[model samples]
Target chain A: MDVLKINGKEKEFTAGQFPATLAELLEQLGVEAATVVAEVDGDIVERENFARTRLAPGGSIELVRFVPGG
Target chain B: MASIDEKLRRAVVGVAGLGGLGSNVAAALARAGVGRLIIADFDMVEAANLNRQQYFLDQVGRPKVECTVENLRRINPAVLVEAHNERLTAANVPELFAAADVVAECFDRAQEKQMIVETVLARMSPKPIVSVSGLAGYGKSNAITTRRISPRLILIGDGQSGIDTEPILTAARVGIAASHQANAIIELLVDEIKASAP
Candidate 1:
């Protein structure tokens, strides 16, 4: 099994069961890509590049969204 | 000899909205003796904004950027303020904020906030941006806080209390978040100074 840390929490998945790309992971998590910004392993993944950025085992990802109003 | 406060006075801050968060953040920075400010907004003041925004009753119907400039100057006459009376778009963010040392994302809408943040991150890489989220309604001031997302990005406000909730936005809670944003900017500036020091 492989694991990915999301927003500071660890979630485990079978090997090769993890989403192949950041975009897929976001979709699996039901997060609207436009509403949140994501950083994987300390590097920001630009919105347009989410699909091309691959997720590796033991990787850390942080997704942050706006709080609605100022 | 230049003091640390004087170093703050030498930095330029760009504020992208003049509503609740932007206005209050600008005012806080001005009071803190920040040297220069470049503020932008296209909306005029309305009675509805008086609840949690910085403008007074008399300023309603006036342009927010104009009122904000006047108020900022009143707070610190020595501070230089450049007011832009126009809406911010991704196309103009780089040009408008070219002179800013740090940019504050103070928009009201989620899409707009995302737009500004994306624009800044894409176009102005490495420039620090202090933004807010979730500071809506009253009570539980402790809920509002500041989080550092990256070296260039900081998020402020209670992560959960948004406008979609029950109580509604008020002066106290919003002010707390605004202050947090302002203080975060100061802390970032101090860190920058230290990092650049010999």
Candidate 2:
């Protein structure tokens, strides 16, 4: 069982459903990558590097949409 | 404590986005005795902005940066104001705010706010970036609070009240967030000062 914590919620997945890369995780979650930045296990991952970055099993991921307004 | 004003006066601050948050932050910083302010805003003041923003009716049609300079100077004639009447981009944000001790992210759009926060945290690590989120609509002034998102990133606001949902931007509600941003910046500066005090 590969359970990844996204934002603050915990999502469990089987090996077949688990996302291999950070990009895949974002795509699986249907989050737009063009404007969103990812923090995987406290490390800031740039938008362009999402494809090459690997997701850690049982790691925490915070996909902040960045609370809006001024 | 007597020298706190001297310290604030010697420090430089940058304010990006001269709308409701930016304008009010600039004013509060000026009043707080901060010596220099680098303010940027590309848009012109509109009549609709008068509802919540710090701009006046006569100032409408004028560039926001220019009006901000005028308004800030009126609040504090001694405070030096640096006006940038252009949009801040990814390439330029780091450069524009490099000289500032602290940068205030007061943009309206979520993407722009994220960009500023990311750019500063990546390119200019250790330099604090103060931002506001979800400062739209009326009531719940108590809900507007400041949070230290990271060691160098301090964000202020309700984190839920956006224009898309609340859709009503009142002066009182927006001012609460703006003052929170201003106060957070002051706290950061003062904290640094206290840390170095010997």
**Native-contact fraction for each model?**
0.67, 0.58
What digit string (tens of lDDT, one per residue) describes model 2 on residues B31-85?
Answer: 9998889999899999999988999999999999999999988999999998999
Would you estimate the TM-scores of all the predictions? 0.93, 0.89
As for candidate 1, its clashing pairs are B137-B168
**Stretches of model 2 off by over 4 angstroms after superposition:** A5-11, B193-198
DockQ winner among the candidates? Answer: 1
Task: Note the residue pairs that clash in candidate 2.
Answer: none
Model 1 residue runs over 4 Å out of place are B193-198
State the TM-score of candidate 1 restricted to chain B.
Answer: 0.94
- Candidate 1, position B149, lDDT: 79
Q: What is model 2's DockQ versus the real complex? A: 0.55
Model 1 chain B poorest 10 in a row by lDDT: B189-198
Looking at model 2, residue A70 earns an lDDT score of 66
Per-residue lDDT of candidate 1, residues B11-57 (tens digit)? 78999998888999999999988888999999999999998899999
